[model samples]
Target chain A: MPVASLREVQKRFWDSLAGAAGIVAPELADAVVSGTTLGSRARLGIYADAYASRLIDVLREDFPRVAALLGDHRFEHLAREYLARHPSEHPSVRHLGHGMAPFLERRSDVPRFVAELASLEWARVEVFDAPDATPLAMDHLRAIDARDWPHLHFVPVSALRLVRASWPVHELWAGADPARLAPATTVIRVWRDASGAAYHAPLDARAAEVLRLLIAGAPFVIACEAFTDRTPLEAAQAITALLARWIEDGIIARIG
Target chain B: MSLLPHLGHGIGLRPPHYPRVADGTARVDWFEVIAENFMIPGGRPLRVLEQARTLAPVVLHGVSMNLGGSDPLNERHLGELERLIGRFEPAWVSEHLCWGAYGRYYAHDLLPLPYTDEALAHVADRIRHVQERLGRRILIENVSSYLTFTHSTMPEWTFLAGVAEAADCGILLDVNNVYVSAMNHGFSPHAYLAGLPPDRIGQIHLAGHSDAGTHLVDTHDHPVPSPVWDLYADAVRRFGPIATLVEWDDRIPAFEELVAEAERARAIEAEVLGARRQLA
Candidate 1:
């Protein structure tokens, strides 16, 4: 019998993992997959099962909250469908779920909050592994000359991320009961603490605006100017309190 | 000969066992980390690796090198591994003899390769490229195969020996994989062991597998069965004591349980080599 080329063999094996049973290469089935108690189809089934289960298990880890909200049966179903649509592109399993949230968004049974929850969950994984930075402390802020306060630009930590959602995704991430998944417009800050634990905080519109402007390299006074709906005194107070919280949370990498 | 040291006995450093291992009190000679896990931008995994490194040496074993694939090497993946090796300075790095991806599609499992001369050349060239990029030689392990290619003319061990010799790499020699593949494909495990080039054997791996009624899957979730313990004895007797590790990747038990398995490997190796010396 003629032997199949490596390329032909790989395409068949890869396609067979997602394909129906008995779809493996003809030579692999006839001459390669020698049988014992198990038939060749059953042997191939072991690998096929492992391929799906391993990738599905990875998705489950990355989107635990989303999986919890949807339940296991539905999540597994979604995982299988997602795998067919988005075969892993990278060598590492950690990257297999890069587009899971977007994939979840297109599902019919999925609520927007569930997809948003997936986004938050994915963000946490990212922040958990993101590069650490030396955060700016209250002492660092105090060290800054008051004369440069208006011109100061705060550098955010590498792990710091801001995500906007149509639902209160922070509640879901904090283990909110599925029955109470209220759809409220929310912006949340996600970052890793010094010991590498990930935490998320819900941000008010004013706080989100300040963080957005500051993250975009806006000067301190200009960042505070984003609170147009509030009084100047109120905006100043909110900015002061927000800066203190960020500093305490170690989200500010530097203030210049 | 291997520049890698005989690091006594060790277990795969799983995430669930991190708290105990990082507690700085867990007794272990070394920890085997999945190289891909630490090949990340940054986060708790690296932090945990730092903590584990303080306790014992770590070996970076990988599953996705795609050494037997037809496509060109993934430079980005190689670069990430190089950076990781620089950071961890592991005792050695190892990957399977099988491929994991083709083109942009990664199967994420150790897919079987035909042990034909053409494939031997293909994989050896890839291993050479990998060694050049890594700035150090690597060890390639035999994967527990669910299927074999009719095109594979030589036995798996002959292919492994050929690749190691042709590429100038070392053999990791996963013993349970030999047992599992032998059972699944009707090959003699003893022949598989004897066929290996002795000088190239750098490490040995012992892992648990599940019998799925029809066939056994290399699950690495349970205790090492008696047959594998018996096989490990043969391996130590034949290869004459190499660096061995217990791999428990799925449904990992407590750190104590994992450590106990590693200890079992230590005891078995001692018993076997001791008997060998008496016979000699």
Candidate 2:
């Protein structure tokens, strides 16, 4: 091979390596990095086997609670398949296996509970590494008066994420009875605070409405309008109560 | 380009221990930060990194240098890296001896490279180019590989030391990875340790490993195993107490737990320093 052609060969070698890692394909494994084992063909299987196992180990570590619920046998089955679909896009293992949820959702063999559980775990990771921000200080909100409230802008905390699912993922995530897993439409909020800690909160209808408005950049008065029939003060009190909780959790960044 | 004489042991300042490092509570001499985590467009990663920088001297360790790749180096990643160096002004920059992305496809894991003569010349030139681009020589650390290439001409340690010498860079000797690779490949761990050129070394990495039946895995999620710690002590004796660090990436206990790990490294460094003093 020409000296210049070596670079092309190197590139092809890496592509084959990634393909093998994703699918545990024997042919691809033979072309990339591998160790010799028992038989000529059997040797490449070592890389395939090792590749899947390493990724499975990473996924299990990242989603231990989910793994605990699914148990080893089922979790390994799902994790191996997930590894075949998502071969990692980011250099950090922190970003690996993020596509497990979509992969789980697409699989007919995956129980509905499994997909929801994976979604919740994946969301937890997303929220954990979400960027940090200067949360809305109490004084910053106080600066906005009722007159300018309609024009007020709001910023959601970097950690604040609203996830709605057909199943109670939060309940299932916390070691709840897997036997009791049932479809219950729900919305949950996950966020980290100024102090860099993560929290999960189940949203009631009223709070969820308020959160929607807040996320849409609505002001205190306009956002309260969606609550209906309540006086402005009532709405203010509800919004204040919710804001207090968010502020305490370090979720609210600033009133825009 | 190089660091001030390494102040002995340090810790991979992970998020779990961020608070302790940020508040000056962790009794660590120094900390190594992952360069990419802080390579965001803008936000808290930088803020926290700045806070950590204030606590102690920081070293920039990266996962995406793709040192062994055949493509032109990722100038975008290098630009981000340059900005981070400007902001944090890290003592030195370091990356693995393996490649990460090939073309646009990134494995995310440190993929092994063939240690043939062609690859050595190819990677050495790239390293020299990177050094010129960054305006400073950096350290290249060895990565643990599950498999070896059939085309490999030299042992991994020889290739690693050769890369450093050829590129005029330094070596971030990851002792745990050396031990892990030794176990996986059925090589002598002590021989691997003894073979490294101590003068070419800039830093030391001491991390935990998961014990598999046939081979040990470099998980960096658990506490340093006893045998690895023993090897680390031997490393300290050979390298003369370079800037050692404890890396606990997953199953991060508490801030105090990491400090306890750092404290363990401190004990080893002290022992090495004390023995040297006695000999002197």
Candidate 3:
């Protein structure tokens, strides 16, 4: 044998090495690979095992809460299923499980609870590495004139992510009983602390609606007007509570 | 093309040991970070990198450059690597000679490449593109493999030398990989080392491997075994105090234990180079 066709060889080798992909292109595996103490196919099996399991290990680390709820056998089943559906296209293994939320949702055996938990975990992962920025101090807000207050728009920190789930993902992630889960819709805010730790908390519906509008690049007046049916006092109290929590958690990047 | 200095014995900068290194409890001449690990936007890893940099130099060691792939160059990957280089200003950046990706899927394992001229040309072109985009010559390390291609026209060492020469890049001589591959594929480690050009060597890697009776896997989990340490001595005698790094990615030890492993390399370097001086 002289020179192997690089294109044909790689196509076949990868197709065969990827056992999860389920297609065995045999030309390269037939004649190109040399057998040793271990058979050629057995040798390739080592790499195939590593490729599938390495990414599974990455997912296990990323979604420990989901794994805990699903149990090791069930979680490994979903992970292998996820791997078969989504081959890692990213350079880093950190992003290998980017599609876990949607993947879980698409699975017939995976419960809606697991999908929501995976979403919440992925949000935490995104917030864990998002760029850091200085939060808005009270002076930055108080210095503004009363007239400009209504027009003020908040710049949420780069790490802020809103995960809306059909179940209480925060409690489930914090070790709640999955079997006792009630069907509920909740919007949770996940953010990185100033000290670089990640945390998530549930938000009230009215306040969460306001935050949703703000996250969509809405002005303070419009966001506040989202609570149109509420009384003036109730609206003012909700906005005050939201801003206090945002500021305390260091999620507000700027207000102008 | 080599413009970097010899950063003596070092350890792969791992997270478990970050707090100690940042707080000045651990000491090393330098640190080698997995480039992909720190390629993210910003986080504790970047902060720890900054803290570690203040103490000693850092080198970027990547596992996924995919130089020998048949697919088109991943411009996005290159751009992220360039961004990381601009921010960290690593003393040197190195990747493997094998390809980890092809088409859209990345294996994440350093897969083997056939040692043929076609492969040499293709990988050389990829390396040139990488060097041009990054504005710096990078080092390429030979990877350990379980099987070799039947159609390989040349030896792995010759192909490594050819790729480095053609691409005008430096060589990151991984002695542990050489020992592991030599043991696996029935090759002479001495011949492999002799095939490499002395001037092209920019760094050295010392690590542990797992023996499975028939073959050895380059698992950097345990301590450097006796055979690998002997290979390191042989390398020090030939390369004369190159930048050596201890890689224990799995089952990582305490900071002091890792430092002691690095210091072991320092002691071996002293013993090897001292004998060379006396013989001369």
- What are the DockQ scores of the candidates, in order? 0.75, 0.24, 0.66
Clash count, one per candidate: 2, 2, 0
Native contact share for candidate 2: 0.28
The whole-model lDDT of each prediction reads: 0.85, 0.75, 0.86
Candidate 2 local distance difference test against the native = 0.75
- Per-residue alpha-carbon lDDT of model 2 for B45-164, expressed as tens digits? 566788877777889999977888776788888988899898899989999988777655565567677777887887889889889988998999999866666557788888887887
Docking class of 1: medium
Tens digits of per-residue lDDT, candidate 1, B30-120, equal 9889888888788778888988889999999988888888877888988999989998899999999998887678988998888899999
Kindly report which residue stretches of model 3 are placed more than 4 angstroms away from their true locations once superposed: A1-3, A19-24, A32-36, A226-234, B1-3, B24-26
Please give the ranking of all candidate structures by DockQ, highest first, separated by commas. 1, 3, 2
Worst 10 residues of 3 chain B by lDDT: B1-10
Among these predictions, the greatest DockQ belongs to 1
Candidate 1 segments exceeding 4 Å error: A19-28, A175-181, A229-234, B1-3
lDDT tens digits, residue span B1-280, model 3 = 2235878899999989988766876688999999999888877788888888889999999888788889897899889999889988999999999987778789888988989899999999999999999999999999999888888889999999999999999999999999999998889998899899888999999999898887899999989999989988987777677988999989999888888899999999999988999999
**Per-residue C-alpha lDDT of model 3 across residues A1-256, encoded as one tens digit per residue:** 4445888778777876565454555555664455458767767777777777788889999999999999999888888888877878988888988999999998778889889999999999999989978898876765767677677888789899999999998989999897887979999999999767889999878878888887888888888886788876677667867887788888999885
Candidate with the greatest lDDT versus the true structure: 3
